[model samples]
Target: MQEFAFELALCAHLERPDRVVGRQLGAAVHGRRVADVCLVEPGPEFDRRAAVTPHTIPPLAIESDAGPGTARPVAEAFDCHPDRARAVAERAVELGFFEREREGASTAVRQTVRYPEQWFDSLVGIENKPDLDRPGDLRDQLRIDASLGLFDEVVLATETYVTGAHLNRLPDAVGVWRFDPETGEREVVREPEPLATDGPGIELLDREPGRAEVRPVTAAEKRRQRRRIAERAYGKGWRTYELPDCERCAPSDAEPADLADARLPWCAWTDGLVRPVADCGPTCPGYEPVDGGDSDGDAEGVPPSEGPEAVRARRSAWEPDPAGVDRRQAGLDRFL
Candidate 1:
């Protein structure tokens, strides 16, 4: 629960008009290495990408041979099985990334717009430990991240007072930041060195007492994985939780003055942020039912308004509803 509160506070602080912030994203190319936070800096074609769809454009659709100029049969465009290709195409069309056309008996699809390859500039992966005193596999995680070089920069965010010994334990390329979840203040303990994102990288797969297993990742694979990460971050922002049905939940006053609008799960009874899934329920003494039942304290229910979607749309570069470009024409001869 400490880590959850810290992560939400950090995400609120990191969100801005120029960048998109997401949490708990898969960052590893081979092994399972989930990043606590992913900051996506926008590129020149950011607006174009946003205009396409509010949801993620399936990676398979982007990698297929479909183009805006020519309509290709779904089976011919995708290398996967016919059913999977059709399903992926249908999803892409639903997301406004692809348009369908009737080509004789078979269905053909074409991209509504060219995939914006430069929509995102860079990705920064952050690992949160909050308490360095209980450092569990922190060194191994940082080492894996550095060797993979998937992200342009990697940093460790914590509330612990980092010592010189802690600095020595971390990789040189990994940076450190001291973050205060209560005050919303951050201090950079060390700046991160840039990784070789353009070149090949080594992925640390497994390590035993005597032997270590690794995989050599090519530059092309890294590029594809980077795009997948960006797409996921764009679709899934950091506010992935819902406010519990408790009268004590007050978002307006829970966060700091600057972050009050974030709509975090702040519990008035506890006088601190609370994880609704874990900290909230009938078992909690402060959990007054939202339906206006008997309560120990004077209870006023949570106010009604638009949910986190509206908050995210107002705060970040994401578009909740975009004017899509999936309009289809009546003729197949034009596509041919």
Candidate 2:
């Protein structure tokens, strides 16, 4: 199967229950390393109360020029969308997320939410490899992930059957999983070793044969790293892409007969499951005018609306708490 198809199927399986999963996340500690999939499970501290609920907070307002050194009032920031921003600014004031103060005889409001720090628990990283026959530089990459110890666990998932030779090439700390993309089923062949998130971790600065350089990580440093990663995962949340809002190919329009196996998106034009990334715009050959537009009224090729409100509507697909507010304070205006 294509790697992308495998990844999507694996993602669907990982998100089968209440688990929140992210794709293509950057988890490098010293260098730029991106993980194929990231799974986050909310801890006891994950405040469901902080979840964005209608009328629970005010509409958000922000200065148009949010660049550094641009001092502006929070209220002035909401000038563009006065009605919505005003209500959000008010709620922000009430919830202590925004602090209203006087500066040089003028009132100013600033955000105070520490974010992901107050909302996430643990993060797990997964690397997808559909064909182990072509394992290119997999060793070094897994080695780096294992040494960083940023993730609680690192897993290598592939469709290839497990072999002793494959295990020998990989670090034992990295777990192995046999996955079947067609069925969206996965079995853990090797359990991963838990990484120490609170203690010093080996940082591979330079490694060349006998000459190797590493740095010591303090618990405080680990804490900072964890917060940074959690904050990123909270913001990126999985489901970076969206399905085309095409009525003809929409799940709602699929025939009852085709609804089996979850009916995957069926296209009357193509007479089969539409390509996952197939273009379904008015310009496409398969485009057929439907009586009604997309349920959301947004046309094909148009990405879903972004912002706290949109996220709250699709939170489960985006973050651990699909019911919660967007972790990014900038997108928290949904409550307003």
Candidate No. with top TM-score: 1
TM per candidate: 0.92, 0.64
- The residue pairs in collision within model 1 are none
lDDT of 1 by residue, 1-336 (tens): 389999999999888878899898888888888889999999999999999988889999999999877789998999999999999999999898999987799999999888999999999999999999999989889998899998999999999999999999999999999999888899999999999999999998888899989999999999998999999999999988888888888776665854566778888899888888899999999888886642112212433474778778877899889887746645645636
Q: Report the CA-based lDDT of candidate 1 relative to the real structure.
A: 0.87
Candidate 1: stretches off by over 4 Å = 292-304, 326-336
> 108, model 1: CA deviation in Å?
1.7
lDDT scores of the candidates, listed in order = 0.87, 0.60
lDDT of 2: 0.60
Which segments of candidate 2 are over 4 A away from where they belong? 52-96, 105-118, 205-216, 245-292, 295-336
